[model samples]
Target: MFTAVFNSFESGMIYAIMALGVYLTFRILDFPDLTVEGSFVTGASVAAIMIVNGYSPIIATLAALGAGFLAGILTGLLHTKGKVNPLLSGILVMIALYSINLRIMGTSNIPLLSQKTLLTNIQDAWAKTGIDDVLNGLLTAIGLGDSLPKTWSILLMMLVITVLIQVGMSVFLKTEIGLAIRATGDNEAMVKSFSAHTGNMKVLGLAISNALVAFSGALIAQYNGFSDIGMGIGMIVIGLASVIIGEAIFGAKTIVRATLAVIGGSLIYHFVVTLALRVDFLQTGDVKLITALIVIGALLLPLITEGRKVKARKKKRLMELQFDHKSLEEGK
Candidate 1:
């Protein structure tokens, strides 16, 4: 059970990167970018093919990020320049990426079991440096040696990466261009009035958003030891769920708080999914359905709470009015 929970947390941390990208578009840019599903696969497909072709894993991952950036640019162009509806532009790019990803992989799936991935290399270095022993010693001294996980090194690496990305995003969002992007999302006309090119902001924001998402895809492909054509299916829903869950729990008044909430929400989301899968009637095939239901529930939770608050306020006002009427009658 400990291992299972730990694994879920690790997965959540990885997916949190993608969720952050989604938040950029969905929340910051107010762009309904459906290109995520395709951009994600583009990242995995590019990374897998490059790695299989004897390229360095880092190089392959960077290439995936580049590909995702280009995909986002195309979508942005379609929406901004070609005058296509934003939603339709995303759909078109997503459809086109399906073929593009297949061409990159030259097949529907690519296995990476024997390949050296970033995670494996880091894990190897950790073992060689004897860090595990030192960590074990610390845990033993604390009387928790038995609780130390075998994949602690990988977990640490992932945590560090996630934290770095979060910090980078927080810093970037405070920059001039970043503020412009946020402003563009909030009020395009106001940004335009300030002489900022909303179109360029949209393009830049989408590019950065898809780049992070693709990076997550590259990491996931390597972690899972394979990349499948269908791996990106329903990614948008998962990303939205993570963003909404985080905001709902952590409150998104500040950028830093919002990013932290995204990471926390991802952990909770994955843990819930893992727990649900343990049920007797749920099979692997039901995973998508479970994800959909989880997203629906998360999306509705805020509305449900708001509705109850409204009712309570109304009831209180009614009681206050009744008290005032009684006071008037008594005074008369």
Candidate 2:
């Protein structure tokens, strides 16, 4: 059980990066970019093929990020410069990437079990540098050493990496360019009135968003030991689920809080899914159904509470009116 939870935590950290990317487009930029599914596969494909060709894992991962960035730029240009509908533009790019990713990979899947990945090398370094010993000692003291096994190294590394990305996102979104992107999402017409090039902002925002997503994909492909063409399917829905769950549980009133919320949401989603799959009757194929139910609950919970509040307020007002009428009759 502890191992299951730890694995979920590690997986959640990686997915949190993708969630942050979705939050940028969905919540920050107000762009319904379907390029996520394709860009995700693009990242995995590019990274896997490069790694298989003996390229450095870091280089392969960065290349994937660049590829995803270009994908976003295409979607943005198609929508802003080519006079295409935003949704249609994303669909076109997404469809195009289906072929592009296949061409890059030269096959439907690429296994990285024999290839060296950033995480694998980093794990080796942890052992060489005695970091593993120190962490093992700490874990043993906490009685989790049995269930956790060698996962401490990975958990620690992912924690630092995810926190760094979260901090970096918080910093970036507060910059001048980031503000422009936020304003564009909030009111495109108002931003245009201020003489800002909203087109450029959208392109830049999407480029960054997909870059983060691809980065996550590259990591996931490495961690899971294989990158499959079908792995990216339904990724957009998962990302949206993370954002919705996070924002609902931890109000996104500020940049830091919002990013933190995204991370928390990702963790919660993974944990829930992990536990649900352990049920005797539940099958692995039920993940999408679970995600759908989670999204529905997150979206409706606020509305349900607001409706109850309205009813209570109405009742209170009626009671006060009745008391006032009784006092008037008594005075008469």
Looking at model 2, residue 52 earns an lDDT score of 94
Provide the clashing-pair count of each candidate structure: 0, 0
- What CA RMSD would candidate 2 show? 3.2
Error of 2 at 8 (Å): 0.8
Compared with the true structure, what per-residue lDDT tens digits does model 1 show for residues 75-147? Answer: 9988889989989999999999999999999999999999998778888888888878887798789987666
Please give the RMSD to the true structure for each candidate, in Å: 3.2, 3.2
Each candidate's TM vs. the true structure?
0.89, 0.90
What tens-digit string does per-residue lDDT give for candidate 2 at 1-332?
Answer: 87788799998999899899999999999998889999998999999999999999999999999999999999999998998987888889999999999999999999999899988988888777876677668877988777645646677788788889989988988888878899999999998999889999999988988988888999999989999998889999999999999988897999999999999999999999999999989999999999999999989987887799899999999999999999999999
Q: Model 1: which residue pairs collide?
A: none
Question: Lowest lDDT 10-mer window, candidate 2?
Answer: 146-155
* Stretches of model 1 off by over 4 angstroms after superposition: 133-148, 306-332
* Among all candidates shown, the one with the greatest TM-score: 2
**Residue runs of model 2 more than 4 Å from their true location after superposition:** 133-145, 305-332
